[model samples]
Target: MSALSSSVQAVTALWNRMPFVGRVASQLTVVNIFDCATRLAAQAFLSAIPVLFVIGAFAPQAVRDQLVESLRTVMGLGGATLDQVQGVLTADSGNVKDASGAVGVLVTLASATACSRALQRVCERSWHMRSAGLKVVMWRWVAWLVVLLVALIAQGALHDAFGAGALLGIPVSLVASVMLWWWTQHLLLGGRVRWLPLLPGALITGIAVVALTWGSRLYVPRTLERSVDQFGPLGAVFTLLSWLIVFFACITVGIALGYVVAHEQPFDRWLRTSAATGRTDPADDADLAEESAQRP
Candidate 1:
């Protein structure tokens, strides 16, 4: 516990010290944000095709009604707008038993593959690693996609478990969200450091994600209404992309923080001193490597 406490303290101190590192990290994220968001947006759009088919074609009326109720209750959507959104989400393709079609499956698979590939690239950049061999990439792609699917399903259960109606839900959701982010980070980037070291970053990311999810429900309907009124059906595209942008940006920043913290890079050292880059100094590259090797 003593060692754990010290490690946590070191991370906190470094985080408080590294505004410049954070700024540089932010710039780097901006460099990759558009590409990541585009891939994620494509995946979402493609996934909706199958989801709509399932809801409209195979789901019982009771299930559909429950879904509509959830949306209206959670997202503050109703009336013609809710109907319009539901209309767009629920497809008229296939029948009760055969809701999914060959085309829908093919497009969905392709979009998921693209998303995995894009995420692999982003993770590599975030971790400052050179690209891996095809086999490694392929394995990670499959694993990450499965993990993502699980996360999507689990979030509904999580929200139910940590009912947002009460004050208790806030801390419970934060812990749940942290666990989810930890799993995601480990899956997407592979282990470069001890898992415990990433907890602080995951904690921050989880809070941000939970906050955004709660806030988005309140904001998205209004945004959707405005977007549709001004841009017609194309407005939905704008609305979806805008949501993706915010999520992807937060994820990028969170991962960046995870990297720095996990590597035990003390940004406070940089902040505190105007030391010349003296290789002979104790706080040099060799010392950093030795410390990293010591981190187990």
Candidate 2:
């Protein structure tokens, strides 16, 4: 028993001595990142899907076409699989078909804020910050949702900008993704965290998005077709939900990683150094040193 106890202590001591690994392990202990991702994905499926249905049913034809094309380009959808997704989105359920006026659309968009709330929790947990009150962030939720839809709708053009090879498109997409996620973190966090600290996570998310975009373009279409062929429409649902889970997982992990990267060792010093040197914005001063002292 003594020998076993000693061995365990020694191992724990070794792990504790390794700074980088310890920080990562600490972050993981602090946040169940994969679980957060799963919840975000599921929430998006439940909340965002209805909004998509509403948009498909009522949005202008040009907007609808752009949305569909964006989906096609991003997910590499075509043929039966694409048709299945379209059918689901455009389904004439009496409530949705009967839905008219801005009231219904606004309600659907409001429901979609559940996703925003989920994402907000993700950012809060990742950064080890207290939650922002709904009153403070209520409009942010809707605004973020609107921005998200616009970004998605514009995805096809972004991807095809360099003649579909995405040679130049990839870099452009990376920058756009970084900017979007950076703003998203700031917006969702109610600007509690400095932009510089947020940049690492945004960059991580941007790279993840670019990689996943290419991965989906390469892997999703054929796999989706096969799944649909084998299990009917339900297969598409499973496949997409699976994809969403992975996508959200990457995002959650990226945020957590960004936190780890930003706060750990030399990077944290750099942020402090930047602040001291006046390179960062004056607004960053108040919160700049806050995260450094809170490292796990």
**Which residue pairs collide in model 2, if any?**
none
TM-score of 2: 0.84
Q: After superposition, how far is residue 150 of candidate 1 from its true place, in Å?
A: 3.9
Give the worst 10-residue stretch by lDDT in candidate 1.
Answer: 271-280
Residue 208 shift from truth in candidate 1, angstroms: 1.4
Error of 2 at 99 (Å): 2.8
Alpha carbon lDDT of each predicted model: 0.59, 0.78
**lDDT tens digits, residues 1-296, model 2?**
99999999999999978878887776765567777778878888887567777877766767777888888988788888667567756666455667645687777887788888888877876776666777889999999999999999888888877466668888878888889998998899887777788888899998998789878987998888889899988888898888899899888888878887886678878765244221344354335334432422
- Please state the error at residue 237 of candidate 1 in Å: 2.2
Question: Cα deviation of 252 in candidate 2 (Å)?
Answer: 0.5
Instruction: Give the per-residue lDDT digits (tens) of candidate 1, residues 132-155.
Output: 567656776767776665455345
The clash number for model 1 is: 0
